[model samples]
Target: MVERVTLITGAAAGIGVELARVFSSNGHRLALVDRRGDRLTTLASEIVAAGGTAPILICCDLEHPEACDDIAAALAVEGVEVEFVVNNAGFGLFGYATELDRAEQLGILAVNIVALTDLSLRFSESMIRHRGGILNLGSLAGFLPGPGMAVYYASKAYVLSFSEALRQELAPLGVRVTALCPGSVSSEFQARAGIEPGLEHEILNVSASDVAYAGYRGLMQNKRVVLPGLGIKIVPLLLRLFPRGFILAAIGRIQLRKRR
Candidate 1:
C-alpha cells in the first residue's frame, strides 16, 4: 500500500519547520526534505515527541540537478506517494548581479527555479490522482523588480507566475495550487541574503509560525495566492498604484543600503 504524505522541502528550519508542524498537527503524514541531515533528524525526533508520525526525511540539497529525482526514488522505496508538495527550499545573494560569482548566481536558479519547477511537475500526477495540493512560497519581491538580489527575485517571480497558471490547469483535475507571498519575513533568509533588518522589515515582517498557518489554511481553501500579513496584503495594490520607474528606483535605493 502506498502511503500518501505531504512533502515539504527546506524542512530543517524557518517557515518550512513551522509548516511541517502545522500540517502534522492537522493529521497529515509528512515527508520532510532538507540538505541538513542533522537538522532533519532533530525535526523528526521533535515530531515523534509531539505525537505525530515520524516523517520520512530526505536530506538532499535541491541545488543538484539530480536532487529531485533522488527524492522521488527515496520516497518510492519507502512506499510513499506525494499527496501534497511545498516548494519551500530557496535562497538569495545580496549584490549587483554582475558582482556575484557566476556559478553561485546559477545556483540560485538551480534550487529556486529549476528544482522547484521540477518537483512541481514531477509530483503532479500523484497529486492529481489524490486530489492533492501544492503550496509554493513566493515572496512580495516577486511582484516587483529587485536590484540587489536580482536572481532571487526573478526566481520568485517565476514561482508566482507558474503557480497561478498551474492552479488554473489543475483545478479541473481536483488539484489546488497556491502561492504564499509574504513581505519581509523574519527568518534566516535575511541574514543569508546579506540584508539587514531595517524599517522595511520591521514594518512588514511576519513570524514564521504565522506565515505557516496562513499558508496551510490558504492551501486547504484552494486560494490561488495567499498574502499573510495585513501590511503585505496591501503591497500588490500599492505596486499597481505606482509607476514602474519609481518603484524600481525605490527598490534600488533600499537594496543599495545593504552594501554599506
Candidate 2:
C-alpha cells in the first residue's frame, strides 16, 4: 500500500468513484472533490468503512472561479501535499455547438477545459517538488471532431494537447503527466452528456472500475497517454489513414440518435 496523498476531482460518482476506490484500495490517502456534498460525504464514508483513511471531502462546484483557491487552502491547512492529482472533474454537453445554449456551451469550457488546466498547472509545481504524477481525463472525442458534440469534443482536444505538452515540459523535472482516454465507459457520463439511451444500448461499455484500473497502471508506468480499450488504442492510428472529411462524416453519423 502506497502512502502518497492523491487528490481526485469529480469524485462523487461515475469514473471518479471508481478511481477513488482504486487508489484507496491501494492505501493511498484521498482528497475527494465534487459538487455533490451528500455524495462526497457518502463516498468518503465508504472509503473509511472499507478501512482506508477517511478521505477529505471537498464539495465545491469547479465552475466557480474560486474553487481551486478553496482546494489549495484546504490542503495547505492540513499540510497535505498531493502527490497525484486526477483532474477528472469534467462534463460534456452532447449537441451541436450553436444548437446548445451559449451559457451551457461556455459552462462546458469552464469546467472541462478551464478548471482542469488551472488545477493541473497549480498542482504540477508542487508535484515537481514532491515527486509524483498528474493524470488528466481525456476522451476519444479528443482525437476527432464530433459534429453533434462539437464543444465537448473540442474541450477534450484541449485537455489532450495541454496534458501532452505538460508531460514533456515536466518530464525532465521528474514529474510524470499522463492522459487517460477511455471509450464508451458504463457510467453516468453518457446519460449526463445527453446521449440517447437507445444509441447507448448498442455499445458494450467498459466498467468504470476497469477504466480506473487501466488509468492507475498507466500513470504508474509513466505513460504519456493511455487509451484503455483495444478499440481505442487503434483509433488514432486508423484515423490518420482516413481523409479528414470522411472521418468527420463517419463519426457524425455514429453520434446521431434514432427517433423514439
Candidate 3:
C-alpha cells in the first residue's frame, strides 16, 4: 500500500517551514516541494534529526503550468498518496500593478492562484478517499484591496474564495479544507514583496510558527477558515465598519507608503 503523506508546497522557508515542522512533529509523513533543493535537503535532515520521518523532497517550481501534474506523478512514483495538502508557495511584487513588469505580475497569479487551485483540486480526490484535509495559506490582504501589491492581494482573494467554496463541496466527502488567512507574518514574504516593515506590519505581525500552529490545529478541527492572532481576527470586523471608498484609499496609501 502507498504510504499516506502530507504534501506541502513552498516547504523551503517561512510559514512553509514551520508548517512542515508542525505536521511532521504530529507524526504526519511529509512530501515537501520547493524550487530550492538545498533548503529542502536541510529541512528534511532537520525533521529526521528531530525523530520525524524523512520528508520526500520535490524541487520543482510551481510557476510552471504543468507543475501540479508533475507533483502528482512524482508522488505516485514514490508510492505515496497525498492525504493532506498545504498550498503555501506564493510570492508578491510590491508596486502599482501597471508599473510592475506585466510578466512578473502574471507570475503572481500563476503560483498564488493557478498553482494553488490546481494542487487543491488535484489531490482532493485522494484526500476524500483518505478522509484528509487541505490547508491553504491566504493573507489578511485578501479581505481588502491592495494598491501597491495589486496582483498579490487579488490572488489571495481568489484563494480565500476558492478555499471556502471547496470546503463546502468537500465536507460531505470527509475532506476538510481550511484557508489560513494571517495578517503581516514575519517572513521573507515582506522583503520579497518589497514591503518595508511599517507600523501596520509591526502592529499586525505574527510569527510564522504561530500561524503554522493555528493552521494545523484548525485543519484538524475541520475549521473552514483560520485567522491567526487577535489583530488578524479583528481585521475583518474592522473592515466591516469602514466605507469601501475610505478603506480602498486608506489601504492604498498604506501600501504605497511601504514602498522601499
Candidate 4:
C-alpha cells in the first residue's frame, strides 16, 4: 500500500522535527522542508535509523515567496500527494523596534508572516481538494500585545487570526485546520532570538514533544485552536479580560526584564 505523506516546514529541528516524528510514527510518509540542508539530511537519516520512514528533504529558503510554488512542483515530480501540511517554519527577533535593523525586521516578517501565509494558501487548496489536514504553528504571544519583540508578536497575531478564519472557511469542505499555539518551548528559538537559556525556567516551559503531541491530537480532531499547556490555555481568557493598556504595560515590563 502506498504510504500517506505529510509536508512539514522547518522540519530540521524544534517543534517541526518533533511533529514529523509523531506523524511518521503514526504511519505517514513525510516531505520535510528546511533551509538547512545538512541538518535536514541528518534528521531524515535519524528518523530512518529509528525505524521510521525516511522523509524527503527540501532545503529551500522559504523566505522567498516563490519557494512555495517550487516546493509544490517538486512534490508533484516526486509523485507525493500531501495528505497533511504543518506550516511550522519560523524565527524570532529581539531588540527594541527602533534599534533593530530594517533588513532584520523584514526578514522576521518574511519568514513568520509572509512565508507561512503563502504556504497555507498554496497547500490549503490541495488539502481541500483531497480533504486533508493543515496545522499552523502559532505562539502564545499571538493572544496578547508584545512590547519589545514587536514584529515577532505582530507576525504571530496574524497567524492566530489567519488560522482561525481559515479553519471556519475550510471546515465545511472537510479540511481540518488547527492553529497550534504553544508557550515557551524547549528549542533553539531562544538562542536564535538572543535570549539566554537559563531564563526559560522563569516562564512555563514545555517540551517540543508536548507541543507536537497536542498539535497532532488537535489536528486529527479538527480543533480550531490548540494551546498545549493548561497555563497557556488560560492565557487567552486572561488576555481578553485585561484592559488593553494594562496588558501592554505588563508585556513591556516582561520584555524589558528579558533584555536585562
**Top of the candidates by TM-score:** 1
In model 1, what are the clashing residue pairs, if there are any? none
RMSD of each: 0.8, 2.3, 0.9, 1.8
Candidate 2 collision pairs: none
lDDT at 121 for candidate 1? 97
Query: TM-score order of candidates, best first?
Result: 1, 3, 4, 2
TM-score per candidate, in order?
Answer: 0.99, 0.94, 0.98, 0.94
**Per-residue CA lDDT of candidate 1, range 1-260, in tens?**
67899999999999999999999999999999999999999999999999999899998999888999899999999998999999999999999999999899999999988998999999999999999999999999899999989999999999999999999999999999999988888888888877788899889999999999999999999999999999999999999989999999999999888789
Candidate 4: tens digits of C-alpha lDDT, residues 1-260? 43357999999889988998899888888999999999998888888988988788888998786888888888887877777989999987888989988888888888888888887787766687779988999999888777888989998999999989988888899899899999898798988888664453445678899999999999999899998887777878877787999999988887888788
For residue 244, what is the lDDT in candidate 1? 97
When 3 and 4 are scored with lDDT, the better candidate is 3
The top-ranked prediction according to lDDT is: 1
lDDT of 1 at 235: 90
- Give the poorly placed runs of model 1, Cα more than 4 Å off: none
After TM-score superposition, the amount by which residue 185's alpha carbon in candidate 4 deviates from its true location, in angstroms, is 0.9
Superposed model 2: Cα runs more than 4 Å off: 1-4, 197-204, 258-260
lDDT per model vs. reference? 0.94, 0.86, 0.92, 0.86
